[model samples]
Target: MTLAPAPKPAVAPPSPHPRRWAGLAVLSASLLLVVMDMTILNVALPAVSADLRPGAVELLWMVDVYSLVVSGLLVTVSALGDRWGRKRTLLTGFTIFGLASTAVLWAGSPGEVIAVRALLGVGGAMIMPSTLSMIRTLFTDARERATALGVWSAMASLGAALGPILGGLLLEHFSWHAAFLVNVPVMVVAIVAGLLLLPESRNPAPGRWDAFGTVLSIAGMVALVYSIKQFGKEGAAGPGPWIALAVAAVTLTWFVRRCLGRPDPLLEVRLFRSRPFTAGTLVAVTTSIAMAAVMLLMAQWMQLVQGHSPLETGMRLLPTALGALLMSPPAPWLAARFGTRPVLAGGLAVSGLGLGLLPAVPATYPWIALSLFLLGLGMGSLAIASVAIMAGTPPQKAGSAAAIEETSYELGGALGVAVLGSLAAVVYRGALPPAPAGGGLPGPAADAVRESLGGALEVARQAGAAGAELARQAKAAFTTSLEVTGLAGGLLMLAAALAVWWLVPRDLDVTASHH
Candidate 1:
């Protein structure tokens, strides 16, 4: 009996990293600022335009370049992080971000600003995936990982809620440069804290760096995003956008094939073969598509139509964050009770209901607040989606999973703004009553008015008392566009919900090790 050696006492699993929670704080705080950069820039753009007087093309580049650079570099950077230590990559990103922010002091021209933005994008690309991958490293237990992800998801909502308020406060006291400058101190702290708390992690067996694959990825991403932007600006009538799209299609296809053929690819394209990974990715993409256009429109409406100050608009947006905060922390618990499939699909349904309410309910602030709240509540399911993604992946592949998730968000947002934004523009133009025959506003002013809601408001300001009716009609038309866009987004959400229900396995257990 003694010879059996007591069956080796069923060795217990390893405990989680000692400093994981503290490390999570650093990662979440950094993520908060990264997300904040997007919304804060939106608030500061008017001030920047007034000071710099950038031409239309220059301004567009200023905005689009950051995302373009981020999208292009994400795959390569994420893979690099897997080979070169994730902690080292993240700390380097912080240094780059801090330095780039400091550069704003000397960035007097739009071109300089664009350069700074591109650099920040590089930093952001380095930072974003590393946070998720590190989370996967820090929390080995599946349930604990899910909780950490909830916190991670909630930080994004909090950052969005805070950006406008913070930006507004800064702008009132300082110049638009303050927005960029604000990143320096935060990045400094992140770098210091990350060095102390975050553990080094890498794929121990990561093979050859795919240099050609990197080129193909960067080219494909840039062309793809550029085509979407062009189509948004010029619609489907332009050959340039079509050419870009064709190039993107061919290059991306080649990239995918190359990845599949390699013993060690730049990205694990085969991750899509896993049901949970694909389902989780679909949720992320669809949620982003529904969220982006609506949030953009809402910000404009609150500021231009309702005449709210930037701070007020930011405060109004707080309900969405509040809803997310209330629901996100408990999402894993809910999933434990109901299972991942129901929780995820049900969340999408709830979000769809919220979006549908935008058109169905009265177009008042209170009703809008309610809709936003519901949207946030439903979006809490993203924590579970993330759990599914990371849990299903092998530990060595965490970087790839994180990159795919982040890329889904970026691409989905771009698609949302381009496709739904174009739809809104058409609706707005059609909804606007044409200027009275020949006796109405001058041709240039009329054209400006028809160009966008902002243009209409600006022209109205110049016209003074005579432009009241023009302003009124423009506001109404913009409202109509918002409602129509909301309806379309809601329908898309419902369709996604149905797809998720079918795709996610009913008996899937996120807590159990899958790989």
Candidate 2:
């Protein structure tokens, strides 16, 4: 047969993207800004409220609408990014974010500001998933991808920690509008850099867009988040929250069923079938719940109880970020040696121990620092969580994985604040001392003391010497509340650790291609 057909030439594996690291920098910076925007608004709200003079309902809407919109839009936007193109979607998101933030100057009313915040949410949803998916696209090597994700996770934690500090500094000198304005320059830089550095990526065979699935996702997510807010605020005081819950349950179930049935689902519901994906998601959700709630309570304790400034509170919280920063870069290497199973499970356990230590130690600044450092150290697991998730998922489904991970974060935060916050409120109310035998405080004032520590502090201030006892007791009760809540959070983290230990396979390899 003539020379036995020349030996087939070998085909080389595709080389990693040339500009991947540069692209990651742009992506990480953009992500930091978006995440920081979420918390910065919290610091700006009091000033905005003073100037806008919004009604109780209007203020609630202004605060809640941004997250509601973000939760509602993430699934739909992520699916669209997979079809349209991640780079184009991300750049467009930068434009929307810039324009929306700039529009804050003209937003005179509470409604206008709410609309502006909602627009920012839209941009956030677009930018968030695109960054993750693009990372997946750029880093073809598993080890490199894990390292990149470590950087990504570190940036996210840093952003959350930095938001309040930045907001406080801006508000110290500038108007509340400065909080919104700060985003503009960042967006401008992101858009220009993104265009130059980022590569276009899309699912090569992305199937038909799911219009009906989009509607279901939006309706389910909005209803679900709104229901959580209502229960947290009113606590079964009304039937409205229950009705929304019912709607959420039904629509979400329908959405999940639809996703599972469709070959080209709007969201990759089937990704949950992968054990590593499932374990990663569980870790993300559970850890977020504890971390978000604990951080929130600690911030309040610092400001209202310890009499620290907002900026001071933010700076104190830096230990958590510092811990994460110190540990994150080396997390992948640790996982490679120790195996992903121990790293993921041990991280949660260490975090739980941090919270557990909070209750055991004296509630002083130094003690809090020690606890926070350990907690941040535990947060380093987030990088491994990302590895497990993406490693288990196919390339085409990266957007879906990112969306699921993000949704877990958003939902977990809402749940933590709702559930754990309510628990703290109950403890605070219970721990408040009764009115003096002489009825040192009026009935309404006493009731207000029972309502919240901040309210009690105000009542204390106005009552002068009579209020001094009340203020001291209120602070003590709040400290007790934090301890109880911290314990509960610790327990939750421990439970999650136990679950993760069982869920993740013993021989799991982050570097392997699961798909």
Candidate 3:
């Protein structure tokens, strides 16, 4: 008798462990340090410039090199972690990051500082991918995974908001070096806790490292980001900037072609064929661009024009941090009940509305807090929803998917600063009349004149009443330029919302699985 096939072995649900939560805490803390560093230095840039005395070109490099390096290496380092053990790579990254922070703290010149920051980026590239990849290994249940991701997203948002505040406090009490030194203590704790709590996990069928792909990816990103940086400083239509951009396009095209032909590729290009993955990536990219530009422009407005201290600026931004924190807990439940499409579309539209109000900000506006709160709420909802879609992808492809999401986020930020910043620059330039005959000023004061109306006023204030008229004109011009930039950002965010509505699917889970 054909024996009834042995009853299929019962599949057991993954066992929940208390230690997993501890591991998450350790990972989140490490991630927070990296996120904090990105913005903390913005407040410290002037100090750094004074101490190092870097030239104009060197100053820009010192500020941007870290992000450029990090953006270039993320995919390569992520692929490395998938092949090697993610836990092992993460621990190594933490150790390197600590050492690099120490190097940055002791740096004597602009070149030295730039080198150390770039090293930090290399370490960060290793750390970033491991955090998300580890979550996949630790939590197998969908609901639990979503909850953990929500917490992770909140920590990232909080770290970003807290960076300037933390930097300001350190700068007030100590030297500029304090910013880099601060990471050492945090890294020590992370390394110790991570070693004890984090479990080792690696891909079962991880392919060999693709060295050519690595080179191509790095070359393409650096070229593209560098070109954009040049365009912002110059103009996109400039011949030199166009040449750099063309080189970037060629390198990226080569990289894509290489990936398509490889039996085992560094990045899986096939994943983009999935509608959910593609749409989620687009949303992540566009939202990040819009948000980053707004934050940079608003921070400059608050500090340079409104004359708020860093701490005061951060306090004013509490609406954003609190909004994100409050919205995170309910994201998973909302997505499950209402579907990702509605949530993403609604979140983007709400964020657009919030941004739209900024252009109308009155000199005596009392509703600043409320308007910012709305913006924060919308950003929080969109961030959580986009991340959920990304994380829901299949396990085997998780590393590549995470890399794509991160690449889009970082690239978008770079582009935002480049494109939107250029718009602001143009308006600012046009608002100012050319300097009068015999109005020649020294380079430092001249730069101050170019940056803000307050700087111009301060110059005029020191120069006496003869310069008062020029200062008034500068103030009016600067205010008008800021207004124009704010309106442009709002319109861009609205456009992004429409893009999301058209592209993202109604059901993330089904789309993820099918695609």
| TM-score per model over all chains | 0.97, 0.98, 0.92
Q: Cα lDDT of model 2 overall?
A: 0.90
Model 3, residue pairs in steric clash: none
lDDT of each: 0.90, 0.90, 0.77
Report lDDT (Cα) of residue 175, candidate 3.
84
lDDT of 3 by residue, 161-185 (tens): 8998899888889889888889888
Error (Å) of candidate 3 at residue 443 is 12
The candidate, 2 or 3, that scores higher on TM-score is 2
Q: Rank the candidates by TM-score, best first.
A: 2, 1, 3
Candidate 3: where are CA atoms >4 Å away? 1-4, 13-18, 363-365, 386-388, 433-462, 509-515
Candidate 2 residue-wise lDDT, 90-146, digit = tens: 999999999999999999999999999999989998998889989988998898999
Quick one: RMSD of model 2? 1.4
RMSD of each: 1.7, 1.4, 2.9
Top TM-score hit = 2
lDDT of 1 by residue, 477-496 (tens): 99999999999998998999
Least well predicted 10-residue stretch by lDDT in candidate 2? 432-441
